[model samples]
Target: MNRDKDIYVLLTDTGTVLTKIIRTFTKDPLNHASIAFDEDLNEVYSFGRKNPSNPFFAGFVRENVRGEFFEESMCALYRCKVSQSAYSGIRAQIQHFEQYSDLYKYNLAGMLGVVLNIEWEREYAYFCSQFVATIFKRSGVSLVDKSPLLVTPGDFQTTPHLELIYHGKLHDYTGCEVTAAAAGGSFRTA
Candidate 1:
């Protein structure tokens, strides 16, 4: 699909959103980790690096709302388009069905299944927001009006006016920073 259209597809997929969050760390020189939390501030999944190539690979360390945590391997790769470099192309999408969908049925096991399946494109920020919104919606938390969330780049500068959606409502959870990196992937709880 075209890059723009490919992003639209990602915005619509529940799994792709979660994957984007996980994949954000892949762009960094450090193995940065991400922590996914529930409404009650409980840990969900910890996606981080398993080994160190040089202590710079980004790692994922996430725990469930129930306080469960684990490690997994993650990588970032891109596809090519006719007019774009393969490194900057849009490829297949990803989803976290087992993480969000199965959360109601299973515990970390279900989350792990979903964590094992995060994916996204190389340089799309707007689509990344949609992905984040999808995860919040699927996780069963409603968004409050005017909620604030943070999306940071490699330099740690926050994107202005990024919309925050939660459980179908708009909420302000601004302290959270979503970083898009390049390298290994994982989740972690803080």
Candidate 2:
């Protein structure tokens, strides 16, 4: 039997200048995307600012959900189930990226291509959503029927593959609590 495990998709609106610019184009409240390996989000990854204060110096990052950048961010969390082998594949892919992170860069140009409805794929470079979609695709999982280069944070919301688990302030998220509530226990939302 193939046991299943869950991977988390986190979308957020950090209210930064870059996010505001992205929000203007996408018209989506949440302009950034991340992947979390755990229900409590101890391991969250994204292609974003390397320094919290400098959006220009950006690339692969292991996000701290409790960081000042996310303290007041609005967010939506989704869960996707995958077979054990697929989970292992995803983990291996993340590890590969982590080991060679120096070779990667944030795909700012690709974000422009997204606005123009064009696909711009660069070697070792990815935007936030593109990175997440690429991870799933490379791991033999399809989150949506589209090219990873064309994937946007908003695409995740409309994809049938992901189950919406929580939507609120990132600071207010109690992952295990939310998980229990989603499993039919009572949950209080702020």
Candidate 3:
């Protein structure tokens, strides 16, 4: 029998100038979106800035949510239940992106399309929400009833399929044991 597995969608507002600008256009608290394979959010992926200090250089990234970048981020965690096969497909899709990460580029123009309510498709290019939506689409899972190109981080919250599990400072999240480490490691020096 095929059982269901839970996948996570993390929406965050990092307070960066770019996110601030996005929030203005989106009118939402969280403007960035990421997908996590586990409840602890240890394995998270997104099409976002590869370097914390540089927003221009971006693409597929295996996000370190526990790292300093997300320490003070305001975020919402959502859970989506999928069949075992769909979970495997999602895993495969993420793994494929990880393997060819260098070939991908951030879809800057697509962001404009999102703001203009148009669909923009580019080869091997994706913005955060597009990437997350594509993952579900390619995995044969229906996340939202809309085009991936036009999906916004706030759009995920409106979907009935996703359950909001937590909403607060990313570091203060105590939904799992990982929060203890996140809370403790904040002020510690390496």
- How high is the CA lDDT of each candidate model? 0.24, 0.87, 0.87
After superposition, candidate 3 runs with Cα above 4 Å error: 174-190
lDDT of 1 at 148: 14
- lDDT tens readout by residue for model 2, 84-187: 88899999989998999999999999999999989998988999999999999988899978899988899999999888877777766754224543444333
Worst 10-residue stretch by lDDT in candidate 2?
A: 181-190
Clashes of 2: 0
C-alpha RMSD between model 2 and the true structure: 4.0
Give candidate 3's total backbone clashes: 0
Per-residue alpha-carbon lDDT of candidate 3 for residues 1-190, written as tens digits (9 for 90 to 100): 6499999999999989989999889999899999999877888999998998798889999988877888778788888989898999999999899999999999999999999999999999999999999999888887889999999999999999898877767867733335544554232211
Candidate 1: deviation at residue 182, Å? 36
Stretches > 4 Å off in candidate 1: 1-31, 49-157, 161-190
Q: Worst lDDT window (10 residues) for model 1?
A: 5-14
For model 3, state the Cα shift of residue 15 in Å: 0.4
